[model samples]
Target: MRRYLRLYKLFVLQYLKTLMQSKLDLAIGIAGFVISQASGLVFILLVFTQIPEINGYGIDQMVFIYGFSLLPKGLDHLLTDCIWWIPGTFVTHGGLDKFLIRPLNVFFQIACEKFQADALGELAVGAALVSLSIARGAAELSVLDVMLFIVAVLAGTVIYTSVKLIAATFSFWYKNSFHIINTIYHLNDFAKYPISIYPKFIRIALTAIVPFAAASFYPASYFLDRSSLAGSIGIAAAAAAVSGSAAYGFFLLGLKSYDSSGN
Candidate 1:
């Protein structure tokens, strides 16, 4: 276990250095952070203007959701670098061969290659938003609430990573099928708001079928004192387990189809 962790650390350092060498990568990363903050600002302003509150979701809750969403969203982009190339190089040229030769897990190697340094800005913005919301909103949050909130967020990360892995794994059979990935990206829009506000069907789909809610909605709601302990943790935990298993299955199945470059 320690050896694996050490190798993973080295992988991360090498990838980070590669990203640092590229000016374009730095620009894109910063751009992503700026765009996220700008979008959050616009949403907050728009929601604040139209109705003093959105279905009883206070500005603070909304901000908390915004901050919550950006963390995994940013980390996914930063850490899982090969996510964007699922339908392209990985599929067409069998780019995954390189990883197979490495000692580390292929998925982890791909993730390391796709580091998101620019998300530093998003992390900063999110932390600031959370602080501001706490200052402006209610105090005296219980310790349990904080713990549950952390659990929900961590679970959300697992769900997001698994979903992307599932999407990427599809490339094994279908070349250039990242359209599915794009669709998943669109679905992420719903996560910015409270899932409870959606129709029962949408809520169900987010929880059961797609599980995007496990990423931000449940966690943010838990933090804001909206979701029940049983429901929120249950959904998040189920998503982590099920999606992780699914990703693993897809990966093993896909490995059967891989033809090394020399062959």
Candidate 2:
């Protein structure tokens, strides 16, 4: 266990070195993040202007959801963004050979390659929005609510990684597996809103299957005092276990089928 932790640290440090070497890329990424946040603000204003309340969720609630959604996603961009393109790059260029030859875990190595500086803006904007949402409203957070919020963010990160892994694993057969990743990310956008607004079938699918709801909605609901903490935690736990297991299993299956193109 200690050995594995050391390897993970080493892998992350190497990525940090690479990121530092490319200051221009990091600057561009940060600029893009700021633009995206400005756009989000405009979107929120437009949305609230039309609907006094959207399905019992006010603009403040929407802010919480939007903020929570971006935080983990940004962190994912920083840490595991490389996993997003592993499928196309590895299969097309036979890049998996490098991972296969490495002394450390391949997943860790792949994860380290994705070090996006845009995540700094994401983290900053997300935290700012969350605070603004809570403070602007009369809603007060108890200790338990804060704890549940933490769990939900952790769950969100796990779900994001699982989805990316599943998408990348498809490269074992389909060289264009990044399309699958794109689709998942598009669907995950709904997590920026309350899942209750969706049809019952869609809600059920998201809560029990893909579990975009568990990542943001559940915790947001808890913060709004509309759901039970126990139930939300239970669902998040189940989602994390099932989705993560499925992703790792797919990766293992893909590993067995890996054939280097010697590129």
* Candidate with maximal TM-score: 2
Cα RMSD for candidate 2? Answer: 1.9
The sequence of per-residue lDDT tens digits that candidate 2 reaches over residues 1-263 is 69877877886787778878888888888878967875887798797998887888788878887887887777777778888767777776888888788787788778866666678888888888889989988257779778767777887788878877887788888887788878876677787888878899989888877787877777667777556766776677678889989998888888898888774
Error of 2 at 230 (Å): 3.1
- Provide the clashing-pair count of each candidate structure: 3, 0
lDDT (C-alpha) at residue 25 in model 1 = 71
lDDT, model 1: 0.74
Per-residue CA lDDT of candidate 1, range 186-251, in tens?
687788787768999998888887888877877676667755766667778888889888888887
lDDT of 2 at 167: 79
Alpha carbon deviation, residue 24, candidate 2 (Å): 3.5
